[model samples]
Target: MEVDYNKISRQYDDVRSADLKLISLFSEEVEMNENTRILDFGCGTGNYADKLQKVTGAKIYGVDPSDGMREKAKAKNSNVVFYKGNDKNIPFDNNFFHFIYMTDVIHHIPEIRVMFNELKRVLKSNGKICIATQSHTQIEKRFYVKYFPTTAKVDKERYPDIEKIISSGKEENLEYINSVTYCDNQLVKVGKEFVNLVERKGYSMFHLIEDSEYKQGLRRLKSEIKEKELELETAGGTLVWFKKK
Candidate 1:
């Protein structure tokens, strides 16, 4: 799936803030010291950077493949050294990071195993790696699949299961830390919110809907949200943290 970096860079904080609470909790779960070095994988616009820094006062390094995203992140946190990187390779040197964070980035990565291996390569002997990803069972996934089948196909193909993620880390010789799950669902205004999300992030690129299809899909979605009490849930990603043995 081709993500619109410019669009997502704009909505980076607003659309993704839901998981910040849980991610923050995961940050606390780690026993970080003052001098810890963190590699924030796919650190879009530095949302996690601020929280992680605030919580641990650790040096932050952000990696994103998108120039737009890296630019935004650099702008947000002047202290953060943002670099461009893709799924297959990270820009950092081997055994350089004390902690690696991959929050909500697994779905966007084209090659999962390569990224996992890269993380393992960069981590210190006892370094920790934390990853957050959307739940397999999510309302948005369900509804979006019904209207636009491509979204489902793309997501399933892109998002590896947490078990697979953990096992991949194990193959890299990292010990399993923990996987935490948290979810919150709340009724929200359907039409306005949906429009806002699309307008903000341009998820349109990911949509198979044409202008005509979008009109019909919007109507159908509105009706569904209205009838079923459409709820925006922060189906928190599985936070799998591991340490290199």
Candidate 2:
């Protein structure tokens, strides 16, 4: 199931370009200050580190397992440290980070409790881990679900239920700050944006679908886009934060 991200890493930036505005949703919910030492766990392609650095002026560090991805992250911003690491085996010292956040990355982590243990180790007493992810319950809102059926199907299987996250937090004795689920503003785009986004093949869901199925989906998407402007309502995920006890 391990797709060669070394190849996928190359196109990662082109497709998942940093959206400060979108990232702002995370920032607003987390409410971090300039002095907060943030760890962007599972920082892929380093696209978000610099944008976050610009927004918060905090000492940010990005840790990822992929050297290919780490190299790109390092190249993105020197101020924001990027290195090879993961949740269970982070490179930095214990009680080192004030806040940790991951976007659209938790579903990929197989050992959730192992990660929670590591979070307990490094996160400061005042630190919090903020997770922005799509809950299985919200799958119906996924805008491309019809187009990318496998993506939705895979997500349902992969995405952890909200209760698991909350229960995991409790097991670790981390205080849950509550989880909020809200849909963001819809992306009203014409056909061109829709076509361009699909062509990028940056979405992980696209990787699951067969090539023939993907092509068929693209054709369907394009045809629909051409007929009229598409007001895409991408599914909104959940943000759950936990503070060290």
Candidate 3:
């Protein structure tokens, strides 16, 4: 099931926030500076874009398809400009961006090839594109999957394989730079707090699951929390890098 960002835009930031460590990693990898022109592709709510601009003082632009999401992003009053656009039709000129980054967004794109081509069109020569996503192993290892098993199946179906992403980029003449996996040592919510987040459908997978399945999973989760202190593991994902040559 496709998650509706327009409907969830208001509450999207209630649970989701920019990960500082990830932003720092992105800054270092892209070598962003005041002169850098960065595009945050599929930048939902402009969380990372806003933070990155503050961290590196880069000239940043955020493009997303959802009007509501863009509205929420614009509310931030940051230097990063937000635009209503998508992979097929980016609202920018050729070779305009020095770097492009997408965070946990590739799975939402239907045409990976089209997105790569579009990225290549807007990215300057030797500019980099960074995709932050979870590998199949990482998806299976997600904390809530044990309770909501269907989420794992759904994610596996939606998210392209890591090698497939690389090959797709190569098809567009984008050179594969490298891939790295990182984990933030911070603990996710625990016990009742975690249950509250799940109940609120903090993750998109929660919205995809059937109502019956979600209820069942919630019951199981509640039972576990009652039995023992449930603490979610560290947050992590893989960063796949490609360069426009």
Tens-digit lDDT string for candidate 3 (69-95)? 999999884688999889898999999
**Alpha carbon RMSD to native, model 1:** 3.4
Q: Count of backbone clashes for each model? A: 1, 0, 0
Off by over 4 Å in 1: 10-14, 139-150, 184-191, 201-205, 208-213, 222-234
* TM-score for all models, in order of appearance: 0.80, 0.91, 0.94
Superposing all C-alpha atoms, what RMSD in Å does each candidate have to the true structure?
3.4, 2.0, 1.7
**In model 3, where do residues sit more than 4 Å from their true spots?**
184-189
Give one digit per residue, the lDDT tens place, for model 2 in 1-245. 54566778887887677756547876776666677888989998777778888878888989888888888888888899887877679888899998888877888888788888887888999778888787886775677778877877887778788889889878988999989775654665557765777897777767777888889989999899888888776566688888897
Per-candidate local distance difference test: 0.69, 0.80, 0.89
| Model 1 per-residue lDDT tens digits across residues 1-245 | 34577656766666554345765575677666578888888887788886777667788898888887788777776877888887777877899998888777787766666777778888888888878776555524444456555565556666777778878877767798888765545334345566456545345334434556556665676677666655543433467788888
Which candidate wins on TM-score?
3
Could you tell which candidate, 1 or 2, scores higher by lDDT? 2
Top-lDDT structure, candidate number = 3
Which prediction has more favorable TM-score, 1 or 3?
3
Give the worst 10-residue stretch by lDDT in candidate 1. Answer: 200-209
